[model samples]
Target: MAYGIETRCIHGEDGITREHAYGSMGTPIYQTATFAHPGVGQSTGFDYTRESNPTRSELERIVSSLEKAYDTVACASGMAALSILLELFENGSHFVCSEDLYGGSVRIFSTIGANRGLTFSYVNTADAELVEKAIKKETKALYIETPSNPTMQVTDLRAMKALAEKYGLLLIVDNTFLSPYFQNPIDLGADLVVHSGTKYLGGHNDALAGFLCSASKDLADKIRYIYKTTGGCLSPFESFLLIRGIKTLSVRMERQQENALKIANWLKEQEEIKGVYYVGLPEHPGYEINKSQARGFGGMISFHTDTAETAKRILERVKVISYAESLGGVESLITYPMLQTHGDVPAEIRERLGITDNFLRMSVGIENGDDLIEDLAQALKGE
Candidate 1:
């Protein structure tokens, strides 16, 4: 029987048959570096850990199923996954990317990619015309982050897909903000879907991992080749943790979204708050577009305090929410993008994107909605 997404999350799409690992209910972690050959010429499917491992393979399969992709490549980190995807283009090829992306992404593209002779043009991808105008003959890809990191800018995937088709360019989406449970970019005609599995997919701030999923066999093969060659694959133990985290993704996302909406609304009512940038809020520019394309508005919210001093005070005073860098964990995290996630971005660009000292980004967790709101209220009140 075909199952719903919730069912798929728990039992997986294929329903977890016991054929793979000697009837064990849970997928076994294959920790060895190398596998022995059955005979002189025959060998086990897995030869080396760097090339492939059973545990990581299972994690990749589950993620691919979730994204409805032909295949997925598991990597050491989100940047590693992006590095593999960038390998599709030749050294001199260029890409048009979202202006307000994660700071680490911008750092890598500007430093590492630039060192390798790859070039990128940063634009607000929500404006399809601007993205089109930014593309040159050397541009090979349209890379974007929807409900963009820290800023919560949403890009229309269908519009980007149309542009990519017209220019014969690949459409790569960073789906880290909204996990596959809320948004599936591949279903919207994305050529490649990338994620930071360490965030929502892991659910806990425990493991570090990344994933790249694609429906095109050719693209999948190219990613796999680069992934194996670079040797930045996720460890088997981390893969096991990722699988455990993914099982509860549906329930966690629902609770997180609920809490986020309440918090965002409460923030808007507070006199100390300047603005709230959450896709769920009707005042947000991309609220309607996000509603049309995604199942949920997601739990990430960025708000500005009346002053930079107030922002710093709240960061130090929050007892319930941890002051941290990462997001999408069970525990709520509040980060100052100016000195944290977007610190690497140039000052001019950061100012233009509104990632300023007065701004704070929150990743709402599965905590009780009222308690979270009360905690924020107390923090804002300097109690």
Candidate 2:
């Protein structure tokens, strides 16, 4: 049988044992911003904090081992990691991306990136034919998000990988939601995998960090160059905290997954719920592909209520679930796409994508299942 998630949580990357250390259970935080050289014109170890540090190296090794990648580089934020990845391609290169990516990513691509000679086309990547037709000779990368935001549409990674190989295109996947604990994109043939460690990997939403991992040495080198030169690397102190958070990732994720499934089922049966979107639900369109790639359905679910008015009232009344945008925290959060996460998305595209006023997204937490269900029920009650 596979190793249980709890075991992985506790000992996933604790390489050094008590015999090697001073019997301290926790990894020490190296908070210094600079390191000294042994002699003039000679570097003994880490020379500067920006290039590398002991704490950050430990975190990188742990994340790479967990993700089953050859290399991993941590950054100040998820956006910084993405920006570094994009530097690999030259200006005027075309990119094919999914229509429903994270709102911040979409904003960067559409607004800030447009002036850099980068052009893009957003298509429903679920349809292999559509993706095939969108590729141009200038296309350099195909960026995608599985279990896409708001709509929860899952993309076929294996199929996309095949297409990328055939077309000489780079495949980049955002594995933030499911995390390396639940899924490893490198195993599925992706060229590069990105994560907002601020989410599940950090587990408590206490750190702002990002990571990019790859199985290829060349790709890893390219990413490392951007990471060091662009100067957006994560701090040593934050890396230490992230390593601490990751020790409990598997257990926390297991609880969150259980909670999400329970809430999804309960919401599906409610009369006020117009539609529920979760890969675990048998009726979901992405079920088969998601099941093949992921060990389990992740802890994110979105649903549409009877109307926008009802959604507004429920959001205003929910007691346990906070109305927040970021996810993967111990406490649950609810967000409205059109007004929150996807607020920057154009009105026309939002309507076409069914990110209507009635839609609500729930980032389920490791809370008592019954209590969470009751909160939703009462929030939906007509007063």
Candidate 3:
């Protein structure tokens, strides 16, 4: 019988597999560089750390189960996983991608992908017609990031999937924002799902890891071969941390989402706040579409302050929230997109996306709701 997400978060493949060697309560870290073989003709499942490790394999299995993927490959970082995923296509291949994406992703596609003779066209994938118009004869895939980075633009996954099917293109989704507990794009017809495990799946600020979960076995086999060949695998220790973090994913997301909704509503009522971009809010442009596609609106929020000075003041004055770049930790983090996450992005595109000096992105944590609001209130006072 299929288990619920909360149960999966804690138990994983516990009774289904003899994964733990000693049947330990926690997944043991196989902290060795190599494993021994019984004989020349036979072997253990693992050979070298670069190829595989029992600890990492167990984490991959757990993620695969959560995602309902044919297979999942864990990598050193989100960028590494994205780099490997890009390798699947040949030279001169083209892709239609979400316009409002993470700055790092835009950097990669414009530089490394461009250098490799790959081409990409960025469009508002939330509008299926625009995405369809961007497709070319050379297009091999439709790449999307829903509730897109910092700005919170939600895309229609099923619509994108239909476009991909109609055009014979692969549908790849970055599910990092919602994680597996709240959203599974594979179930929505995405060919592959990507995650920055360092964020939600890791659930803490401690470990760094990435994952690429494939819906098709053929796609899984291809990426697995590239993964081992490229050797950007996750460390056994980090894998152990991710496994521990994932155990608390359901609870963490629940509290975070609750906090985010309250904060977004409060932001909307503020005189100095110009706008709030959070899917959880019913007034958000993509709220209904987001509701149709995802189980939750997630904890990420981006808002525009009345002035650049007000934005700066909050960054300096906030006592409860930390001024940081990374998100999805137990601690709430507020970031300046233009100065931090989107600094590398071109000025024109940044401006078009409303990532200005007055814009602030926030990642709500499992903290006291009233305390967080009070902290914000104090920070925004007299602004």
**For residues 214-305, what per-residue lDDT tens digits would candidate 3 score against the true structure?**
99989999999999999999999999999899999999999999999999999999999999999998888898999898899899999999
319 Cα displacement, candidate 1 (Å): 0.4
RMSD of each: 1.1, 1.9, 1.2
* Candidate numbers, best lDDT first, in rank order: 3, 1, 2
Q: Write the per-residue lDDT of candidate 2 for residues 1-383, one digit (tens) a residue.
A: 34444554554454433422577677777788889888999995788888888778888887887777899999998998888877888889999998888998988888757777899899999998899999999998889898888789999999899989999999999998898888888899888898988988887868899999888999999888788888999998889879888888887888999999999999989998999998889899999999999987889999999999889987998899888888888889999988999999999999999899999999999889899999988899955
Question: Candidate 1's residue-wise lDDT over 88-119, tens digit each?
Answer: 78889899999999999999899989988999
* C-alpha TM-score for every candidate: 0.98, 0.96, 0.98
lDDT of each: 0.91, 0.86, 0.92
Give candidate 3 misplaced runs (Cα > 4 Å): 14-18
Better of 1 and 2 by TM-score: 1
Count of clashing residue pairs in every prediction = 0, 0, 0
Indicate the TM-score of model 2: 0.96
Higher TM-score: candidate 2 or 3?
3
